[model samples]
Target: MLKKQFKTTRVFRFKRFARKSYSVFNSLHKTVTIGVLSGCALISAHATTVEPAERVYTQTSTDSIPPTELDEVVVTASKVDLPLNLAAKQVTVISRQEIERAPVRSIEDLLNYVAGVDILQRGPHGVQADISLRGGSFDQTAILLNGVNLTNPHTGHYSFDIPINLSDIERIEIVQGPSSLVFGASAFSGGVNIITRKDPESNGFAKLEGGMYGLFGAEARGAYKTENSLHSLSAGYKHSDGYIANSDYNIVNLLWQSRFDINGSNLDVMAGLNDKKQGANTFYSAAHPNQFDDTQGIFASIRGETGGRLKFIPHIYWSRHYDEFQLYRDGTPDIPATYKGHNYHRSDVFGMNLNMQYASRWGITSFGGEFRNEGIMSNVLGKPMDDTIGKYTKSDSRTNISYFLEHNFIFNRFTLSVGGLLNYNTAVVDKFNLYPALNASYRPSKSLKLYASWNKATRMPTFTDLYYTTSTHTGNSNLEAETSEAFETGLKYIHPVIKGSIAAFYMKGRNMIDWVKTSSDALWESRNHTKINTKGLDATLGLDLKEWFGANQPFHSFSMGFMVLDQNMVESGLISNYVLNPLHYKFTAALHHDVLKNLSLSWNFRWQEREGSYVQYVDSQPGERVDFTPFSLLDVKASYRFPHVDLFVNANNIFNTTHVDFGNIPQPGFWLSGGASIRF
Candidate 1:
C-alpha cells in the first residue's frame, strides 16, 4: 500500500512540475523574439560608427627548430610561487581570454565545465550554488580571493556570494587534492583562488545585456594606472523576474582595489560588497512554497610585502554577512508575533596573517601563521531563551590560531616539498591538531611531467551544522571534526599544439559529517558519520587547431574533459543525505571557429550522470526515490568585434532538454541572451 502511494505521488509531482516548466519555456520563447529584435536594432544603429578589423594570428615557422621552453605559468598553490610544470600539485588555470570567450554568465557556470569540479546550481546567474571537488562535500572545498580565505563560518552555501564582477578577474586557479598544510582547515578537497587584474594599464569597459525571463543587467569597470600605483573600480546590477514563480531575484555588486609601491614595499588594498534579494520557491523546503531570502556581504583586505632573499608578507582581512529568511511571504495568525517564523542571522570573520619566505641556492622555505575569529548572532538558529530582545535568541563566537612551515627542494630535474600545519580551535573538544603533506614532481623532458602527493586535512562544523534548529531540521553541537587523508598522482603533457593531463586520486575520511533522517517524516539531523571512502579520475585534452594544422585551418581551438567518481560508506546502519550527491561521470567539450574576419562562433557541450537516486518527501505522504537520469546540455555563442565595440549572443540549453538537478526542481531550458560591450 505504501509503495503504491509513493508511486502515485511521484507521478503527480513530475507531471505538475513538468507542466509548469513547459509554460515557462513558452513564455521565454516570446521574450527571446522581442530581445533579438531589440538587439538587432541596436546593432544596426552602431554599425555606421565603426569598421571591423581583420582577424590576425601569429604564425610560427615549422622549418626552424624551436628553442627549449620552461612552463611560463606561475602557480600559487604552494605558499611560494613555482612554475606550472614544477609545481607538485595538480593545478588548472583559466585565463582572462578564456573567461571572455565562454558562454557563461557566472563563475559557477564556468567551473561546471572543469574536469573534477562539481557545481550544483539552484538558480541561474549564480544566485545560489554549491561547489564540490573530487567527490568531496561542498563544505570541504575552500574558496579564496587573491589568497584570502572566504569560506563562510555560517554555511558553505553562501560561499558563492563573491563581490567582484567577472570582468575584474584576471585568472582563476584551481588546486585539486588536499591542501591543509598551506590553507589550514576546510581545504580537505582542494582550493579555488580568484586572482584579480592588477596590471598597470589604463583601460575600462561598459556592458549592457538582456535575456529571457525578464533578465537584464548592466556593468561598468574603470582602472587608473601609473608607474608605481594602480586603482580600479567596478559595479554591476542584475535583475530577473525568473522563469517560474517564487524564483525571481535582484543582485548588486561593488568593488574597489588599489596597489601602491611605498619605498621598497608593495602595498595592496581591496574592498567589496554584494547584495541580493530573491524568492526561494523550493530552496530549502518544498512544503513552504512562498519562501524568500535577502542577503548582504561586505569584505575588505589589506596586504603588504617586502622583497629580498628573506621576504615577508603581512595581510589582514575582515568579512561580514547578513541574512534574512522568510518561510512564508505572509505571516500566519497561529504563529507568535515575537517569533513570526522568520530567521535573521549575522556573521563576522576577521583574520591576520604573516608569512616569511627565504630562497637559497639549495631550495625555498616558507613559514606562515594566522589568527582568526568568527562570531554569529541569530534570531532562531541558536540556544533558546526566555528574555528575547527584538527577535534575538542566541549569540556565539569562536577563535582559531594556526601555524605552518614548508620547504621545497629543487633538483636539476625534480622537485620535492614537505609541509605541516598546527591548528588550535577554541570551540572543538580536541583543541589542538596537526596536518601534514608531502609532494614530488619529476620532469623528464620539457614536454612531459609527472607528479604525486599525499596530504591530511580537517574541517570544523559550521554554525548551521552545530546549532541551527527548526521544526523540520535540527543540529548537534556535539559533532566531532571531520578529517581526511588523500593521495593523488598525475601525468601532464604540453606541446605547441597539444596540452593535456590525467590524474587519479583516493581519499579516506574519518568522522565524516552529514545530515540524515531515519524516515521520510523525520526531521533532518546533523551528525558525524564513522567513515567514507572516495576515488576519482580527472582528464583534460586541448588542441590549438590552427597551430596543429600548420596555421591554415579555419577553426581556432578545441578542448574536452572527462571525470569519473565513486564514493562508498564504510559505516553500518547509517543513512546519508548529502553524501550521495556526487556524479558518476561527467564529460565536457568545446570548439571555437572564426566564421569571418571580425566574427567568431563558439559551442560547448556537457554530459553528466549521477551515482544514485534521491528521495524527496511530499507533505504527509511516503516519499519516492527518483534517479537523475543522464542528461546533456549544449550552449552556443557568436560574437562580432568592431573598432570600439563588441556584440555577442548566447543560446543555452539549445535542445530544451527537460531535466531535474535536485529533487523535483526543474531547470530552465532554451535560454537566449545578448549583450554589447564598449571599451576605451
Candidate 2:
C-alpha cells in the first residue's frame, strides 16, 4: 500500500504570511549588523594580530630555484601566498593535470584517492556520498567552495553537491584533522576547499564534451587584463543519466573575479552562482529501487579583499535548497502501485564571514569571525498540526556566531604555529552550544617534521533525528549535542626522490547520538551514549621516478601512493546501529609520458578494499542480524592530448566485480565512459 502527505489548507496560507514578515525583519537586522561589524572590524585592524596562512602548491617548483629551473607553485594555506614545501600542516593538492587524467565525475570521485579520508557512496553520479575524515561522520566535516562554507541546512549529513565540473576546477585542498579552530562549524572532522579556475587566455576559450550514460557538458571563459586591473568571467553546465535507477543530474555555474590596483594597495572581488538538480536513488528502501529521489538547490556568494599590510577579507552568501523523495513497500516495483508517502524539505541560510591578518618581518597573526542565520521547513511525518495518519508540517530556525585567533612564528630552520576557536550557538527550541579548539605544528629539520593538536568539537543533532515521526522512524525532541575531544601527532619526511608521511590520532566522544528502538513502543527514539572513541593511523609514500622514465627530455613522470585506515567504536549501546567499524586500504599510481612532439599520454590506476561490519537491522525473522563482508573495486583511466583537443576514457570497476557494495542495494558492474574537450 502507498500513502501521501500534503500541507494543510490553512497552514499553507500561514507559511506565506510568516515568510513575508520574516523577510522584512531579516533585511533590517542584516543591514544594521553589517554596518556595525564593518566599522568595528576596521577599527580593530589598527591593533590586528599577526598570523601566517598555510601554504599550497598550484604548480610544481622550489622557492630558491630560479625561474629557469622550475615554475613556482603558490598556495593560500597560511592565508598568504607561500611555497608548498613550507606549509605547516599536511596538505594534499589535486591539480588540473590530475583532474583531467582521472574518470572523476563527481566531488566524491575527485577525493576518493586521498588518504585518511572515507567516501561512502550510495551509487555513482550525484546520488549520495557520505565523506568522512578520520572516522568522523558526514556531519563532522565541512565543505567549502572558494573559501565560503556551504553546509546544507536541512541535514548537516549532506553537503552542497559540487557545483562545477572537473574541467571547471583548478585545484582541490584537503586539510585533515579538526579545523574548526580555523574554519568554524562543521570543521570538527576536516575541511575540503575547492578552488575553481580563472580565465587562462586573453582570446578566451570554449570547451564541449560528451560521453556515455547520457553525459554531456560545456564551458566558456574569457579574460581582459591591463596595467592596473584584470577582469575574468566563466560559465559551465553539465548533465548526465546516472549509473543507477532514478539517478539523473544537471548542474550550471557562473563565476566572475576581478582585481584592481589602487595606489600601492590592491582590491579583489569575486562572485559566483550555482544551480543543481540530482537524483537521490532509493535512500530509505531496499525493496524498490525506482522510487526516484530528487534534489534541487541554488547558491550564490560575493566577497572583496583589500591588499594591505593588515589584510581584510569579507564575504557573504545565500543558499536555498529543496529536496523530496518517495517511499514504497518491499513487494512493490520501482513504479509505485499506490501513493505510499513522500518527504519534502526546504532550507535557507544567510551568512557573513570576515578575516583579517597582520604581517611583519618576525611573523604573522590572524583573527576571523562568522555569523549565520539558518531556517528550515519540512513536510515530514508528525510536526505541529496535521491529520494524515502520520503526516505533519515541520519548521525550525536558529543563529550562530563563531570567532578564531592564531599566530605563526618563523625561525631560521623551523616554524611553529598555534591557534584556537570559540563558538556560540543559539537555537529557537534548544539549549545553546559552545565549542573550542587548539592546534599547533613544529618543524625539527628540513627532512623531518612533527605536528600535534587538540580540540573540543560538537555535532548538533540532525533535523530527522530531532523532529521526525513516522511509522518507520521516530524523533526525539530532547536530544543533546554530541561532543568529542581529539588529539593527534604525526611525522613527515621529504627526500629527493622518495617523499612520504605518517600520522596517528585518537579521538574520544561523549553523548554520542544515535537512534534505537524504544522498550515500550515499537518506534525508534534518539538517545545519547557515553564513551565512543575512534583511533587510527595514516601513512603515504609516493616515489617520483622522472629520472627512471628518461634522463632530461621532459618526457615522462611517474608516482605511486598507498594508504590504510582502521576505525572502530569502543562504547557499547543499542543506539549505535550503523557500520560499527570499517577497515580500508587503497593504492594508486600515475604515469605521464610524451607520445610525440606535441602530444602526451597519462595513465592512472586505482585499487581499494573495504572490510565492512555489522549494521543493526530487523531481518525476515524480525530479529537483529550482524553483517560481515568484504568489497573491492578497481578504476583506470587513459588520456591523450594534442594542441586543439584532449581525448580521455575512464573504466570503473574494471574487473566487473559483482559482489554487493551496498548491503541490499544492487549496483551495476563494469561501466565505461569516454569524452573529449576541444579548445581554441
lDDT of 1 by residue, 1-680 (tens): 54453343322211121122233334334333333322221100000000111111111122211112325455577867655666778899887878888888888888877867888777878788888888777888888888778889888888878887778787888888778776657787888888887654437889999999999989899989887888999999989999788789999999998877654445678899999998877777666666788999999877665444454566778899989988876543454455456788988988877666665545678887778888888886666655765666887788887888888876656889998888888987566788998999888987888999999998888889999778778999888888999999999998979999999999988888777776556788998878889998999999989997866657999999999998886643334456656788999999999888889989999999876555665762447765679899999999999988999999999999887666656678899999999988
Poorly placed runs, candidate 2 (over 4 Å): 1-83, 202-207, 224-237, 242-244, 251-279, 328-341, 381-392, 428-438, 515-526, 547-555, 571-581, 591-628, 659-661
TM-score of the candidate numbered 2?
Answer: 0.79
The alpha-carbon lDDT assigned to residue 28 of candidate 2 equals 36
Give the whole-model CA lDDT for all candidates, comma-separated. Answer: 0.75, 0.58
Which number leads on TM-score?
1
Candidate 1 is scored at a TM of 0.87
Cα error, candidate 1, residue 32 (Å): 59
